[model samples]
Target: MTLLRPQIDPQIFSALTPRDDFRAIARWVEPRSSVLDLGCGDGSLLALLGNELEVRGFGIEIDEKGVLACVQKGVNVIQQDLERGLRLFEDQSFDYAILSQTLQTIHRTTAILSETVRVARECIISFPNFGYWRHRLAVMQGYMPVSESLPYQWHNTPNVRVLTIHDFDAHAHAAGIQIIDRVILHKGRVIDWGQNWRGSLAVYRVKRYR
Candidate 1:
């Protein structure tokens, strides 16, 4: 399968300043807790959590360049294809498993979510919200939306499934995963209202039902 590298913001590559979405996820993590970051591009978020929260952090990345970047930053990372699944990790091995901005690219979203919730006590997930007004307008206009959060044209996009926070909430409920926290963002600003149609991005903290 041909892997498409989504266009990442240059700010995501920065070491000093963490991205707002990363920060939002970070807030859910407890200090000194064990964390597994799936698709941890360049290990920026893991590094941030490691430094700020003093967590035991491991990462999984498929791209060799991203793996090398993680190693250079002293992050323990395993280069593996997530689509093949995460059976290697034992259930409840980590305090948290994170799929930040990588869920849309995954073909087996349900399977991955099941495994993630099973392997960790909790999971933190972030993604671009397809229900944003811009995306809705683009669809109505017969064009795929391209914006800062989702910066790709339809033909070259890595996102196989585009979903909104509302969609994800429904999926989580049906899957028996409980959402513990949610943060919505529009143009980098945190918003509380109209998340389904106005928010461009969102982060969710969830755990499997006991």
Candidate 2:
């Protein structure tokens, strides 16, 4: 069964300019394909994909405000805890699944990632790199790192799992997930050198190894 693409206003489209990482994620998604967004906050990414790529998109958000915002943007959204898994969707239900910047916050990281790959032929995952030079420097000084990508304080932070590019690479290898492509970013610009130590954010397109 196919889903209808939401009809968003042109003004809204102009207002909701896709972030740099969101643009990167959009580049990986095929036009007119189906997408499932995990932990979609405010549905901006879904909206952008729907409008620009003409993709049929659905979003899962746990926050009430986020759900409301999605509704306002004419986005299809479900409000549910991500830890419960993506059982609602059948195997390969979407062409792409996105978990942007929410991987570290999820407790059942492995399970969620597995479910994501199960429900989608491909998945896009992005997270803040804990091994960035600044983050390491902060840790060496005996304080938790706080920057634009990781803006939350240690007490109020939602990031439970700290991971770097190397860590994710190892985990993906062990989990039998093939990394099709990867982009490392620092301040929205793609970093080409010393990604593990210099990049502040990591984006990957992956699929379950057959």
- What does candidate 2's lDDT look like per residue over 1-210, in tens digits? 222335565677667866667978998999999999999998899989988899989999888898877877878888899999888899999999999999999998888888888899999999999999999999999999999778899999988979999999999966668899999998889999999999999999999888
Clashes of each: 0, 0
Please give the lDDT score for candidate 2: 0.88
**Over the full model, what C-alpha lDDT does candidate 1 score relative to the true structure?**
0.86
lDDT of 1 by residue, 17-76 (tens): 677698889889999999999989888898888777889888889989988777767678
Candidate 1 backbone clash number: 0
Best by lDDT, which number?
A: 2
Question: All predictions: root-mean-square deviation over Cα?
Answer: 5.1, 2.6
Best by TM-score: 2
TM-score of each: 0.90, 0.94
| Error at 36, model 1, angstroms | 0.2
Tell me the TM-score of model 2.
0.94
Q: Rate the local accuracy (lDDT) of all candidates.
A: 0.86, 0.88
